[model samples]
Target: MAVPVESEAPGGRDVVGAVLKACMLLGQFSADRPVWTLNDLTTASGMNKTTVFRLMATLVQAGWVNRTDEGAYRVAMPVFEIGSAALAKLDIRSAAKPFMSDLATTFGNTAYLMVPAEQGAVCIDLLEGRNSLVVAGINVGSVMPYHAAAGPIVMLAHSKELRDRWIKPGLPAITEQTITDVNLLVEHLDEIEDAGYSLSVSDYLPGVAAVAAPILGSDGAVLASISVGGRAEEFEGAALAAKIEKVCAAGARITRIVRAMPRA
Candidate 1:
């Protein structure tokens, strides 16, 4: 699991605090104010002059920031490379969006598109249905655990590497229904793989349910997942089955679209 980014220093861990401060310093640069000197950065960020200098020097060394002969700093090529990489990942989101919209409209629930991340899975896009009460705490850019939610579980079921990394002892529980037991979760992932979809109830969030399926690459590798989620009470036997079928179909369609895209 990726260590959580903390704003404050934890016991015997100052790296997180340093990372946070560096990010804060970087935030001061934008199109409007693209370049900054040590004095400007320290004053604008309200950080110690020595700290700002150290951070700037580190960023320059790391190729994330560039320093001019005049001692002004600007974001560097690596930053643009990172941005381009993120935009490339959004291609899958574009391919899956129409199907997600259809799922949301037909089911009167929320449809989510999630892509695998270093830590787990990230919700890249979400379309809300006509349901009166929207499920809370989940929005675009929300990072979900690989063992809990239907989307992440679908991801875990399809990827052996993710399963090996995430399905270990003492998996954190987000709700009472969350499967923290390593053996049981392993069995559950096998079932999900055999079924080619996942049905989750109140696992990640209270009173919420979701059905998800994997969107596979041309080589059959799991690329991402698509899911429909709403109130737990609304998901029952036949209704849940129909949702599973729809979500799986959506996943298949998106896989085709992604495959048809021109390769970079």
Candidate 2:
């Protein structure tokens, strides 16, 4: 979890108050404006100088933010750890995409690269199946909600942290078929975990069904995931399992390749 930025000593508010205000102030900066002066934060947050300086001092002390030579403030290196850890896990996605592409071409199933972050599996990259109808709805950078989408479900089933963190409450209802009930969803997720993959039919976008397998690391950690998706009507029951072998095979191959290579 990120420590929300805030500062004390401006109005001499309580420690909690300072933390909250600092967080609110830091939230004001982003990719476009990564650095800011005391006046800049004050204007953006509508807070006074006393508040901004105190807050920035706390941030600078905590290593969450830094001061530039020109006297501007910017976010520091802690954020990189989140991305780096995820990348170390998702290296399988880097290795397996091309192999999955071959399977997509062979089976005409759209292949997906699913990596968990911020309580969902982000579709970092994708390989379209040849028929165009193989996997129709999702695209690159599309997010798979924990309940409905096969990628997140499979990844979550493989990750204790993900299952406990994401599959709890407020599961977004992407479609009428989306599962929001915790108990019912848990039963299904349990089955996915036992089976070593996750499967879903129209739980996310309508008319789409997907099968996913967990991509693991060399140390037996659930790294990322891979999925095969097609139209729900055309691919159900027997048809779905028919493709699972190749999907799992591709996923396993991808994981081995990723685990063998040095972290980039």
Candidate 3:
């Protein structure tokens, strides 16, 4: 009887080339181009059509990709469901939920917890005020532009790298109030860091206003932000100042709670 052996590459390492090719195929999908065809994957991955087709077939069998009747492919529901489940399991969301609910109820404004993402900030959790006439359009999993919203701006103020990358020339205007000048935005970011919060009135939306504070981790790095937003009229004068104070305090408390959790 002859023994079977796994194939080896030039470096004498067992080749799991199929698995690697499958991952490369899946990585081609993105927010901008979520659907792809066999030719696209073959071109993007630099793999031959036969290899791409075989890997994609396996991925579709495993429910990782869905093949359309038109012969195109897209990431299947399982991928998104798994990603959502992972976000739901994060300790920060659990730590911030109570504080967010309290802040929303106390101010009658929507409260949000957002974490930094590759492009902007991702809202992980939110609580709507009982009397809120109109809730902030953002919900959990919303990705906000770094320059257009108070929550993301506060997160950007803490990091020199993020600010440099995000505040490039010709920033997009989300609304009439959005800061478009790079120099002025940098000055405002410095002010936000000094004030320990960012305040925005109709910066992202016409009738909405928000005040946001950053949550720091044990290493003194910003972990996330807590924001309270509502109608522009409600966030005025003494009441607005009070909401800012409360939001800052809640951020501090959530930070402490996050720091106390045992590391994995």
- TM-score against native, each model: 0.65, 0.61, 0.64
In candidate 2, position 107 carries an lDDT of: 61
Indicate the TM-score of model 1.
0.65
Per-residue lDDT over 1-264 for candidate 2, one digit per residue giving the tens place of the 0 to 100 score: 122233343444444676668778777765557888888787777776786888899889999888999988998898546545655656555677687787678767677887878846788778777764644447787776767778888877777777767766776688898889988888888898888777788888788888888888877777788888877764666766677777787777677567656566
lDDT for each residue of candidate 1 in 1-264, tens digit (9 for 90 to 100): 112333355655645788777888887776568899888887787777888888889999999999888979999998877655655666887778789999989989999999899887999999999982476777888888999989999999999888877888888999999999988998999999999999999999888999999999878888999999999987898888889889998987778667655577
Candidate 2 segments whose C-alpha is farther than 4 A from its true place: 1-91, 134-137
Error of 2 at 82 (Å): 32
| Model 3 lDDT at residue 60 | 93
lDDT of 2 at 57: 92
lDDT of 3 by residue, 56-112 (tens): 999999999998999899999998787566555559888888888998899888899
Each model's RMSD to truth, in Å? 17.8, 18.9, 19.4
Better of 2 and 3 by lDDT: 3
lDDT of 1 at 37: 88
Model 1 RMSD in angstroms: 17.8
lDDT of each: 0.85, 0.75, 0.84
